[model samples]
Target: MSDAIEWVAVDWGTSNLRAWGMSVAGAPISSATSDKGMGKLERGQYPQALQDVVRELGVEDGRHLDVLVCGMAGARQGWIEAPYLEAPTDLRGLAQSSVRPDVPGSTLSVSILPGVCQKRGGENVMRGEETQLLGLASTQQGYEGLVCMPGTHSKWAYLRDTHIGQFSTAMTGEVFEVLRTHSVLRHSLTGENDGAARDAGFGTGASDGLARPQDLLGQLFRVRAASLLSGRDSSWCAGYLSGLLIGTEVAAHLDDIGEAAVPLIGSTSLCALYATVLSMAGKDGRPVDATSVAIAGLSAARQQLA
Candidate 1:
């Protein structure tokens, strides 16, 4: 299988590094992953980390392999800095702007795709998500719509005729984890979520958030207050907090989302959570596989480089 591989595709993020051995036709023939991501590695350690994953994909020693990387591996603190391509940028021709970093003592010919940045309306940037957006465009030719990629930092982007016109981001997941682990709210949200109660709590909290997003600061304390007053369990509290954060995010973007079926590009579970909230607002949330699109996006880049 290694002999059949034409090139390798990689999505090296902060916490994880994922790789795929691609065939000559662009389909992934083999795959591998590692916990040794940009956040964990020093500048000099990137080559070894990447080499380990590439070897796992069955690439032989001394064999020349063209590796296309997207994500934080190209950040300033990453292996080598791949500069940001400012938006209103076309997702196509990403390879044209990609940076080739020297990997001493390795047979890997690595190219890191540049991330996208928004400068006019706000100062915003993205790395791996830009590749996923490119993949979205590859799959849905001439695609134009609002895209939501949910994770630690949820990104909402507008694909205007295959060009990334503008985008906004929300730190929904990271904030939830911080509040749950570090804040006073942790005391009230420290247990496994019970299904029915969690659902009920989520619905109530989502309604409150959607109706009064401006009052988010005021609403947060209510979770703890409700627990102390009514003895609400951890399950309800956790669910409520999650729903509230997500709801507020959705509310902020509601004007852009008017009646359109949003393409939720992320993990299945996270997308489902967003889907539930979109449904509440009588809108559709179409789940698109992040991994598949990432590969597709990388493949699109590979074609250009080839």
Candidate 2:
């Protein structure tokens, strides 16, 4: 890679695409993102979609552009299909399995990292978040512990050294969305809130409802029934739903976690909710800023290029 050439780091997911243009030192000089995620793009638009960013950034031809990408862009529906590296693979192993985009007539050098997958009891897969996990692990010393990345589908990963040891995924966020919008409990929610009411609701409800995992589904419906029968407040239903899902997630995984306190990585709201849920389960979780981790991960990958 030339010192003057730009290197691009991409984090593409099902619903969003983010790219960064950086110097060889990995300092991001510019960045761009779009709603044109893998889920929304047609098969043939991948090159042009990428080119749109290149063009916007004025990346010139004859200048080698090294690209490292993660996320759903490695999925079957993404720009190119990157195979899954099973657990215990580190950055070097992942880098070895990288897939390049087939942009015909273009001379750009690109490598997409393979998503991590494993089959302990059943098949579990992660695309983009694993890189962020690696990024978090890369910068920290003796980073052996669990990393919980909360999102539309929350993932809990076991990391030892620089490799991913084992992991599991819970559809907590998707379930929450389904319950809030489609289930009978929808009527009781006063819509989403970003304030103390929401926090109080989640904190209280998660503490109470998460304590009884066997009765979760039953108690979930009670949120609706209680509002009608006992005059429970509707405004707290959002928090209640958040609590139920997070509580179930905590219950399902707490036994496997052992004594290590997992660090929660993602948006602040998500981290807050997960931390609150973990607290309810008698565990503590600390939040790691995901954006910083993303940048750091990209930088780490760039170091390999040197």
Candidate 3:
């Protein structure tokens, strides 16, 4: 298996690390994952954490493999900070700007891909999501449009002919989790969202958010109020909060999105939810596989090594 493996592709995010052993043809033959993500590892511990996962991918001892990594592992507090490539940057040549970290005594030759940043219009930066954009560009030649990568920090980027023009981030997911777990609204949400009642609640919240995004702060408390006054269940509250937050995010970028079909990237469930919200706004939301694009982006980087 090691002999067949040409190189490795890694997406090391804040909470998780995923690695895939690739063949010469750019196909992933074996894969592994670890909880020792950038958030959990100290600077000095990154090498060993990576090495352990690589071993699980069946890389033989003493064998040299080139590992191309993307994501938070290149963060300043991560394994080694890969400087941000400012916006209006071409996603194709991310490998040319990649940094080769010096890991002494390790047989693996690792390169960390730099992330994209926008200084204009209130500074913003992204780590692992850039590679996914690159993958999208690689697969869709000369693509140009709006893309929404939903997660803890949702990113909305405008790709103009494979070059990232500008991007924005929203802490929708993180804020939702915090509000659901820590705020007074926690009493109303049970983390249950799998029924027609939940869907109806989501649609209602999305409609309100889309119509009056500016009133979000004031509308948030309505979840608890609805629960207390109308006897709404936890599922409804959970779905409503999710819908409201995502709707607000979509509303903020409505101008950027226009009437074009937006590509929704991220986990399947999350993408589906975003699609629902976009549908509510009378727009099309096309779901794209986040993992496939990440691998394609990594493969595009590995080719640069050759």
Cα TM-score of candidate 2: 0.91
Query: If scored against the real structure, what TM-score would every candidate get?
Result: 0.98, 0.91, 0.97
Measured with C-alpha atoms, the lDDT of residue 207 in candidate 3 is: 83
The weakest ten consecutive residues by lDDT in model 2 span 1-10
lDDT of 2 by residue, 14-78 (tens): 88788878775667777788777899998788777777766555576556677788888889878
lDDT of each: 0.91, 0.77, 0.89
Q: Write the number of the candidate with greater lDDT, choosing between 1 and 3.
A: 1
Candidate 3 ranges with C-alpha deviation above 4 Å: 191-194
**Candidate 1 lDDT over residue span 258-294, tens digit each:** 5668999988988998999999987899999999999
TM-score of model number 1: 0.98
lDDT of 2: 0.77
Clash pairs (backbone) in predicted model 2: 71-128
How much is 138 displaced in model 2, in angstroms? 1.0
